[model samples]
Structure formats: C-alpha cells, structure tokens
Target chain A: MNWRGNALKFCDVAGLPALEPFVRLLAGEDVKEQLKGIAKFVVLPVAAVAVFLLLWSAAARTVVTDSMQLPSPTDTWTAGKELFAMHSAQRAEDLKVKQEKTMQAVTLLAQANSVTKQAESATGERKETLLANALVLKKKAVQAANYRPSSAPTFVDQIITSLKTVFVGFAIATLIAVPIGVLCGMSPWCNAALTPFIQIFKPVSPLAWLPLAFLIIVWAYSGTKPGENFFDKAFLISAITVSLCSLWPTLVNTTLGVASVDKDYMNVARVLKLSWSQQLFKIILPASLPLMFAGLRISLGVGWMVLIAADMLAQNPGLGKFVWDEFQNGSSQTYARIAFSVIIIGLIGLLLDRIMIFMRNLVSFGDPQAA
Target chain B: MSVAVLDRPRSKAIARPAPPDPLISMRAVCKGYGSGVTRNEVLSNINLNLRKGEFLAIVGFSGSGKTTLTKLLAGLEIPDSGEIVMDNEIIKGPSQERGIVFQNYSLLPWLTVRGNIALSVDRVFKHWSRGERRDHVEKFIEMVGLSHAVHRRPHELSGGMRQRVSLARTLAMKPNVLLLDEPLSALDALTRSVLQEEILKIWEEERQTCLLITNDVDEAILLADRIVPLNPGPNASLGPAFSVELERPRDKTALNHNETFKGLRNAVTNYLVAVRQKSRDDEALASEAPPIELPELQPRSLRVPRGRAG
Candidate 1:
C-alpha cells in the first residue's frame, strides 16, 4: 500500500497523473474507479487526438491555391520524413568531403616534411622553398581539420537552432527579471519606482522591438568582421527581441509571488534570526518558487512564440526562417512541410510546458493542481 | 456577574512584585498602527516580566491584538513606545535566543519533518559536527513522536502532526525563550488535549521560559504555570494574571473535581466576560456621541497616566 502511494506520487511529479490508475489497478484497489480513471485519463485523450486528425485531414482536402494545396496528415508525415532524410544525407556528404580533404592534406604535409629533411643539405632557394611548402601544407591541414557544414540547415537543425535561441533569450530574461522582481516585491519604494517603466514596456510587441534590437546589434558589431564577432548579429538580434517581449510574465509573477509570502513564515525567519541572505534563499525563494515557476512557464511559452517571429523578421537561421523560405519557394511540397513544422512547434511547446510543470511539482509544497 | 469586579479596576487584581532579574521584561510598552486620525492603539501601558524556567500563557479574544503583543515580545515588531529588555539588554530585533512556533505551524512546506527540525538545529548548533547535528535532529523528531514521519513534508501531515513538527523544530533549537503563538487552537479537541499533555511533558523536561498566546482558557490552565488574560479594547492591555497552584504531572481527568481548578476557571471566565461586555458598551457609547461635536479640552497641568494592567 505504501509503495502504491509512492508510485502515485512519482506519477504526479512526472506530470503523468494518468499513470496512477494503472498503478492502482496493479495494486488491486477499487477496480471500478481505476477503470474509470484509465478511460478518462488515457482513452479520452487518444480519442480527442484522433478526431482532431480526422477533421484536419478533411479541412486540408478542401483548401486549394493556384501554386499549392493545404497538406493532409499523410503529406505532413512524408514531409517530416523527407526533412529528416535531407538532414542525414547532408551530414553524410559533409563528413565524406571533410574526410577526403583531411587525407589529401595529410599526404601533402608528409611529402613537405620529407622534402624539408632533404633540404637540410641543400642551400639557398631549395631550402627556402621547402620551408615555405611545409608551412603551406601545415596551413592546408589546419583548414581541412576545420569542418564547417556548408548545407543550408535542415528541419532538425532549424528546430535545434530555434530551441537554442529561445533558451538564450529565456536565460537572459530570467537573470534580469528575477532580481528586479525580488527587489520590487521586497520594497514598496522599489516597486513604485519600477512599476511605471514595466507598465510602459510590457505591452510593446517583439515585432515592434525587432528593428531596434537589430540596430543595436549592428552598432555593437560594427568594428568587427561578420564571422569574427562573438555571436552572429542576426541571432543576437532575434534573441534580444525575444528577451524584451517574454520578460514581463516572469517579472510580474515573481513580484506577486514574493509579495504574497506568508507573514508567519517571515516571523519564523525573524525569530530564528536568520541572516538576510539566508532568509531570502531559505524562506523567500522556496516560498515564492511555485508562482515563480508559473511565471517561468509562461515566459518560456512567450519566448518560444516570440523567437519564431524574431527569427523570421531578422532572417535568423531558425524554424521561422525555414517557414519563410518555404513560403517564398511556393513548391508543391511547401505547404506540407509548413504544416509539419507547425505541428512540430506545437509539440515542442507542449513538451517544454510539461517539463516546467514537473519542476514546479518538485519544489512546490501546495497542491500540484494549484500549479 | 462582574460589573462590580470591573469597579475593582486593573491595578489590584493580579499584579506581582518583580523578581530581581527576569529572563524578559516589558516596561510601560505601548503599540499601535497607523498615524494621526487613523491611529488604532492595540496595546497600552503594558508591563510584564518573565522569570527563568517559567511557563506563561496569554489568553485573549480574537482581534484583541494578542498577536501584536506576541510579535513585540518576539522582537518581530517593535513597540510604538516603551522598551522590551531581555537579559538587561534592550531587544532591537529578533535573536536566536528567542524562537517562535506560530499558530499556523510555519514549517517550510518543501521541507520534510526531519528537514524542518534540522533547519533550526543546524543553524543554532553550527559548531557541532555533522553526525552530532543529525543525531540532535533525530532526538527531537523522536521526542515529538514523529519518527514515522521523518521524511514526510508538511502538506502530507495532518494538522496535529504539523503542529507537532513545529513544536519539535522550536524545541530542537533549544532557544532560551520559546514563544508559542496560539499553536494548538487550530487542532481538533482530542488532538489539542493530546498535544496539551505532550507540551506539559516537554516543558517539565526542558523548563525553557515559554510564552503561549491562546484563546482556550482550559489549555492555559493545563500547560502554563501563570496565565495572563488580555482585556478587550482598542488599546487592549494585559488584564490579570492567575498562577496555577496545581501539582506537576496533573491529569485532565482528575482536574474536573479539583476545587482549586474550579475556582481559578470561574475567576478567568468571569473576568473575560466582564471585559468583553464593557468593551462592547464603550463601543455603543462612542457611536452615540455626536460626530460633529468639538473635541473637549483637557487641563494640561493636571493630566494623569492610566494604570498598568495587573
């Protein structure tokens, strides 16, 4: 019975409450309720997805344009497979080319080394030429060692790129917002000072901020060559825009969480005579974490949504660019690939939210349902 | 039954001569909230002394600012006027010497029973080795009979269990002054009585100077050596103190027929009822007064301070 409770708790933390019914069924408790639980948690969701797919397929068949038709489920599936195949083939080709160049460079360097050893006895022009050739061979070998994939990013690569960009933006936003939020929550004076600025900036869209972000990035990178800079200008611009737009939810939520911490807890801290930092970390942070995570989940979702637009506007190399490029191409398969990307984006967003919920459950003391 | 008793007034009932040195002393302390026209006085001209190894319980009705007084004692909030001295030093803020078990059982929810107790033990006993600290924490957990729930979080525990964990945590700290703020009022009657016994046993063993704020008069008699009641007022102050002369290892069942128990219980009940009615009458008179009337002028040379609650 205890192990069954432990199993149910594990399921709850893992954001799979549906799994509890199976655990209860195995434990031989309340067969009727367990069966109902299984049906409600498992069977219903599958049925809903099936109905959604069927409707999507019917809707896809009805829509048509001069250049392309809307993609059905089968078309989207094929397009997804093709995208994976394209990525693998490109990776293979790049590897083969790099391997061939490396071998040729190694052979040339060996030849150059042997010639330089012979040139020890030789004088003037032959020795100089041998040394220069060796230098050139070593340079060639270094160049061959540097393997850069020249292929335009495949769907998988674009997905990874978008994830990376959004995370970078989310990380920057969290770092900036949490401290500010804590300051505001802890002090009425700070809250008063920051409230006006936050209110003014919060409603500004990523699209509205993109041009300003781009300008700032361009100015910062002006002294350096394009590839020599610390980060690509396009990527930085897109990320900054994402940071600007997605920061508000987390900031607002954290402030609310911190401000609303129980007075009894604060008194306990005082009675303990905990240091300022201890009170913040041990009492304030743990107490506020549930609401903070709620804010973070919202921020991540907003960041993900904003990243696509940022990528498209700045022509950053991510899924949004991929979609924009496909739209421009207007091929027979373009609509299907776009449909596949849309589903993939939605799935990724769902997964990110589930991961946040799992984390919230771990740190939270309140009911998991509240989160 | 007690308008005549109210006429006996405050300075005569329960005041005691001060011992030479006290663990805690509050002198003419006054506390209120807000400013100017909106200022609401909660406690006024309060004087109290807590001797070493004493168990004191403070009983008051809801909204009588019992919490405000406790907060002042804990040094969580400073009084508007007057000084609260502990060990001859005026307390400016909270210190480790004073630990509080709040009424709500303010256990950090994310922490398990062991973790909650360990948090305080580790902080206070920083000089102790890791094994010693863990051993100390386990000892308190056992004392509280929470050994089975050592790894359970607060949310998993019942109300009685949570309060027990809270008690364990405070006792584990080994604070010189253990301030309990209505810690048992939230529990069911059975659990409350069970805990009241547990508290008695623990206090007998440890003998830490404890101050408890509670609404239950029976609880006050059961656990405390001295019981203090707060009068109902906008400026509510300590009314009277009753010392329990009952023997140690007293039983709840046997106390029912005890003559001293009956006498003390009647006196406390009568005092509480009289003050509550008087405050209600004061409210009625104030409402009946004309709102537009000019404030009366007092003779500045002949003003006198109010008497302290005994």
Candidate 2:
C-alpha cells in the first residue's frame, strides 16, 4: 500500500489537488516529476504575478490624472508602509494616554477608598466631611476612567471598522434572508408573495438605497444622543445599506437550494416518520447547505463591495471614508494610498471567497459527484 | 391449500384461504396525475391484500403505475379515492412501520454506509441505546456484505454497493412491511442475481411481509410467493395473481432446469405479452380514429435481458 495515499486523499478533498505532487515528492516518489509539478503550480503563478506587476508599472507611467500621476507599484508599497507607520504611531500615542488616564483613575479610586475607611471610624461632622470628600474623589475617578482616544481613526482602524460593519450587515442579511428563503422554497404561496418584491428590489444598487437608509436611520435614532448607543446613526445607515444590497444573492441561492432538495430524500424522511423540524434540520438543511453557503459567499462579496460605496456616501468611518478622505486630501501620496486600498480590498475578497468555499465543502455531500 | 401448507416446506401458500386478516388491505385505490384535460390516470381500482410474512411481487411494464402503487402502499402518496389499511389502522402518511427500498438506491449521499442505515435504525428504534443502535446497524451492514464500506459515502461505492446500502437502511428499520420498489433493477445481471439471492436469504430469515415490484418475470418467480401482474396503463389495474410453488432456500441455478420454474416463467411472460399486444391494439385504434394531428405514443416494452432469465 502507498503510504502517501491518505495524504493525497486529504489534498483532493481539501481542493488542493496540486499539493498531491508535493506530498509525493516529499514521500520520495520522483524528484524530476515533482520539480515539474512545482514549476507548473507554484513557479508559474508567481512568474505571472511578476509579469502583471511589470505591466502595471508600465501602465502607471502612461496614465496621468489632472492633479497627480498614476501611482506605480513602488509608490503604492511606500504609501502602504506610511499608512502602517501612521497607524502604529497613533496606536502608541492612544495607548500611552489611555494608560496615564487609567493610572490617574486608579490612584483617585485608592484615595477615595482610604477616605471612606477613615470616615467609617470618625465623629459625625468630620465623618460627613470625609465622606463628602470621598464622593468628590470617586466622581473625579469616574471621569478619569472614561478615557476614550480623541485621535482621528487611522488606516488600520478604518479596515477594522469596515470589517465590523460588513459583518454586521452580512449577519443581518442572513437573519432576514434564510427564514424567508426557506419559506419561499417550501411553500408556493410564500414564493409567489415574496418573488415580486425580491425581483423589484434585487436590482437596486447600494448607492440608491443610501439616502433612504440614511433618512430612516436618522429618524429612528432622532432621540438617541450621540455616543450613547454603540451604533451611531451614520454607521447604521451605511450597514443597513450594505445589508439591503447584499442580501439578494443569499436569499436567491437559499431558495434555489431548498427548493431543489431531492424528492427521494423527502420520501425517506416521510417514510421514517421524521418530525417536520427533523426533516428541515437533518434532511433539508444539510442538502441545501452547499447552495446556501454559495449564496452566502456571493452575498459577502457583494456586501464588501457595497460597504465602500456606503461608507464614502454616508461618511462613515471605514476604508471607504478613508479613500474618500485621501481623494479629497489631494496630496502626492493620495493616489498611491488609493491604489494600495484597492489591492487590499481585492485580497480580502479573495480570502473571504476561499473561506466560504472551505465552509461549503465541509457540509457538502461531495463536490457534485458525477454518477 | 390450508393452514397445514403454512407448516409444510415448499408449499403453495398463496392458494391458502384468507387467513384471519392480512397485514395490509388496499380498498378500491385510484390515483392519477395532473388535472382536467391534461390529467392522466395511472392506477385505477387497485385492491390488494398483503398477508403476514408473505412475499408478493407486482410485475408491470414501464409506466404501468407499479411505482405509483408502491408509493401509495408506502404512504408516500395518497390515493385519489380509496383507503389503505395496515394492521386494521388506516394508512394516513408514511411511517416507520413500512420501509421501502427504491430503484435509484435512495441512500442519502452525504451519509456513510453505516450512517445511512443508522439514520433509519435510530428513527425506528428510538428506545434503543446508542450502543444497541450501532450494533443493529452494523449487523445489517455486515449482512449485506458491506462491512468494509461502513465508513464510505454512497458516491464512493459502486452501484451494487449503493443499492446494498439502501437495502440495509430499510431493513435496519425492522419495519413490519418491507417494500422493494424494483430495487435490483438498476444493477447489472451478475450483481442483480447475487443481490436477489441475498434478498431471498434475508427474507427467509426475517419473514417480514415483503412486496417486490419488478418488470422481470424471472425475478418475480425467483423471489415472490404470489406474482401480481399490473396491466398496461392509461388507467391500469391488476390483471391477476399467480402463485409460485417454490421452496425456501431456492437455488436460481437449479431452478433453471426445474419444469415448475419454466412453467411459471412462461405463464407470466405470456400474460405480459398478451397485455402488451392488447394495449398496442388499443393505441392503434384510438390514433386511427383521430384524423387531427396527434403525436404517436412510443410503446415501451419490458426491458428484459435476453440470456439472463432464459
């Protein structure tokens, strides 16, 4: 028996069949063949990427904007480094201020506690005075304890904020889409009821929904004082816009998936006298998961794309806003920074897609087994 | 035929007088598809009584509603105008009491060989402990000679192996009625015969009230005690039931030389041919009457492999 067979099988199932040659090479199958495989898979892709960079740099020289020239690969790299440095510096400054305030609060709290202990053993007037002094110190400590960094959000901060926003939007979309999708899939009446709306709204872009989302969110949070709630009105507006635009793919995919669950499986479930919920969870859900996850992957991609536009329009503190700010900043580094963000966004999208594929394969029966 | 025949080896039990009551009773069952002008009637007035521990086969040509009949009996489909009673209880919906093995080997693809069987076993024997359930599932898997494939998914298995998994899944449920919906029809001849023998062996051991649906006369003769021929459709009905006087542990190879087997096979085949000719004649006459352009209906004959049965 081949000892490397199990490792090869894992590579096959993990959608990394290209790695099988590497495994075989490591197992000492054939050096020449393994080198060829490595050249084809690994070396070729890297060479292609290098060629692409060369083309990009060449193109960058030819294309010139009104205020600035198109940033080259080197310029983008430099801008990226500067952004990282700025984030690090801001982070350090914030940390130092926060630490100082926390220290002050701790000292004040200690003073207040000592005063209260002394007041416990004192006479009436003196004790009352001491208690009053402790109360003032406690108030001061509370004030000092609320040490929020007042610095402008950095590039890294924008990325985190954008990720958080997209996640919130995607989660909301899932919550709204799945049950409705299931209902539509399972029942003709539900499908008929919802299809018209889905068709009409599915094509609407995030930009179109922005103003409406803003109005509704602003109205909803009209009474909410700023900094009181975690979700600021603008953040809600941007995220809701992302959800509205991104939800369609998941909804449509889920519906298709659920609707296409095998009749044979349904018969099996029925004959087994499985409960309705059991049928849904065990048979229906598992069968439909592959398509549902495919939808989710598409939805996430759409959500990420839509979030930038939403942030730019709504002026929410995310990568989109950062891009808009840089565009308005009109510095020599602005084009470079924008180019770097574009690459970053693309990489993030690719990563998300890979993650989704992994999730989908985990639950799928097989990768569409032919016969 | 009498109660004494039940006790005797290789006795014709189908000729026995209606004993006490059957395990299931289908009364004037009718089923159709579509509506109004487009509506096509499949089974008409299907009245069947399946006795306890009886091996019955329903033989029909393709589209003669044999599958529909099985589906009705399995409680997967409700009849248009009749009732199916099982153990004096009216059949309302599918239940764990009636287990079916479908032609397509309807093993859940996501599940391993053991998992497919375990799904049914767990459902039926909810009271059984986890260890007991696993043991029961493993027992059936081994019985089907699929112990090596216990961890393999359906797609990884061959057609024959997949069918075996489906069989194991149904049998592991230990249902009161075992329904085989042309289960071995999808398999190759060699695998078909092997599985047929395995099925015969399992039926002998379990003695579950079995219903085997097939298009093969030899298959019906090989396994079933009573063979019911379903007439060709538009509105198909049962032709008549023939009893096979075959013994338990019957050998297919030996049966090839047996006069009784020859007679039985010929009788069933002739009956099927007659029905086919009649249906063809009816179709010819109906089309001839209509001058208006109508698409000619292709007659589908029973796809019997020439050398295998004969």
Q: Which candidate's TM-score is highest?
A: 1
Candidate 2, residues B62-161: lDDT per residue as tens digits?
A: 9889899999999999999979999888998898889899999877878888888988888889998999998999899999999988999987899999
Model 2 bad stretches (over 4 Å): A1-20, A27-40, A102-146, A368-371, B1-21, B45-47, B81-83, B88-92, B127-135, B147-149, B289-310
Lowest-sum lDDT 10-residue window in model 1 chain A: A362-371
- Residue-by-residue lDDT tens digits, candidate 1, A1-371: 88998898888886897898999999998999999999999999999999999998998888876766889999999999999999999989988988888787788778778877877988999889878887887787777767576888888889998998999999999999999999888888999999999999999999999999988988888878877976778889989999998899999999999999998888778777788999999999889998899899899999999998999999989999999999999888998999999999999998998888888788776578523
Prediction RMSDs, each to the true structure: 9.4, 9.6
Q: What are the lDDT scores of the predictions, listed in order?
A: 0.87, 0.88
Model 2 C-alpha lDDT per residue in residues A97-130, reported as the tens digit of each score: 9999999999999999999999999998999999
Which residue window of length 10 is worst by lDDT in model 2 chain B? Answer: B1-10
**Candidate 1 residues B201-250, lDDT tens each?**
99998888999999988889988888878887588878767778789888
Clash pairs for candidate 1: none
TM-score of 2: 0.87
Interface RMSD for all numbered candidates? 1.3, 1.2
TM-score, chain B, each candidate: 0.87, 0.87
